[model samples]
Target: MQLLSVNLAAPHAADYTDSAGRVTGIDKRPVPHPVLVTAPGPKGTGGSGLAGDTIGDPRHHGGDDQAVYAFAREDLDAWAAELGRELPNGVFGENLTTSGFDVNSALVGERWRVGDAEDGPLLEVSCGRIPCRTFAGWLGERGWIRRFTQRAAPGAYLRVVEPGEVRAGDRVTVVSRPEHEVTVAFWFRAVTTEPELLGRMLAAGDALPEESRERALRRGA
Candidate 1:
């Protein structure tokens, strides 16, 4: 697979949620140069793992488990067709717009070597992105959260395992795939709609994000 674009967010004033007049970085755009990728510590202290990018709200958006976000160009096309509007590479707030990648179907903990074998950063699939009021407001779509949840195609959030530089057109290679059925799509469905599937998410093991893993543990995972 190829990295179609490397997107970075810019802070913009948006009064879309209870926090009136808050700045948000949901509208990310493609950049021209290579960007350094590294683990941004933890969620509370860390922001976007992409060197120049910053998380507007660290309270719920950025952390080690969600250091990077990836969305497939195919998925974006599907959404465009469904929404009857053109959706660009980074329109969905994803840092990486991937081509020919099945991002949603990736197994939790699956590893990818981005760029090259020797110099690329290694990334591990962590979890599916959950929709929030900020996202819904950014899209200006009615019942956006409900609609996104029903679609069950939320893009995958990944953690940086090895730090390196990444840029547009870089190749993405799957370094490893753990034996598991807990895919990004399935996990999103289980956590949002089918609480029954919560217990099964544990099969993903430590690759699963701490937040979801804890919930699964409470469910006797």
Candidate 2:
């Protein structure tokens, strides 16, 4: 797989409704040059991991577990066809727009070596992107959040295992795959709709975000 584009956002007034009632930085655009990717420290403390990108809401946005968001070009194309509209890369506020990758099927803890050589950035799949009201408002789609959740291919959030520069056309190699079967798609479904599968998520262990793991453990209790 390869990186189709590396996108970043600038802080701008969002015309969408959210808990903040005014959102910003959800509109990301692709950059032609390489962008530095690093850990954002932790949730609510750091902004986006991308050097120039802005995170409007830290309460739910930037964090170690969600340092980078990736979406597949193939999935965007599918949405375009379904909506009868052109869906471009980064339109979904993803940091990386990837091609030839099945991001939804990626398992939590799966490690990817992004870029050219062995020294390239290492990223670990952390969890699935959860659709929210802000996302619905941005898309202006009726029942968008519910629809996106029901579709259960909500893309993937990644943690930076090794900081490095990434750019459009960089090679993306799956360096390691977790032995567990709890893929991002499955985790999304379990958390969003299937409570029965919450216990199943525990199999992923620490690969899942601590918040998610706790939620699953609580529900399963």
- For 155-206, candidate 2 gives per-residue lDDT tens digits of 9999998999999999999989989889999999988889789998999998
- Candidate 1 on 1-221: residue-level lDDT in tens? 99999999977888874432588889999999999999998887899999888677887888899999999999899889988999998999999999987999999999999998677799999999999988999898888999999999999999999999999999999989999899999999889999899999999988888889899989883
- What lDDT does candidate 1 reach at residue 60? 88
Question: Can you tell me which runs of candidate 1 are displaced by over 4 Å?
Answer: 17-21
Worst window of 10 by summed lDDT in candidate 1: 12-21
Candidate 2 overall Cα lDDT vs. reference? Answer: 0.89
As a TM-score, model 1 comes out at: 0.96
User: Which lDDT values do the candidates have, in the order given?
Assistant: 0.91, 0.89
TM-score of each: 0.96, 0.96
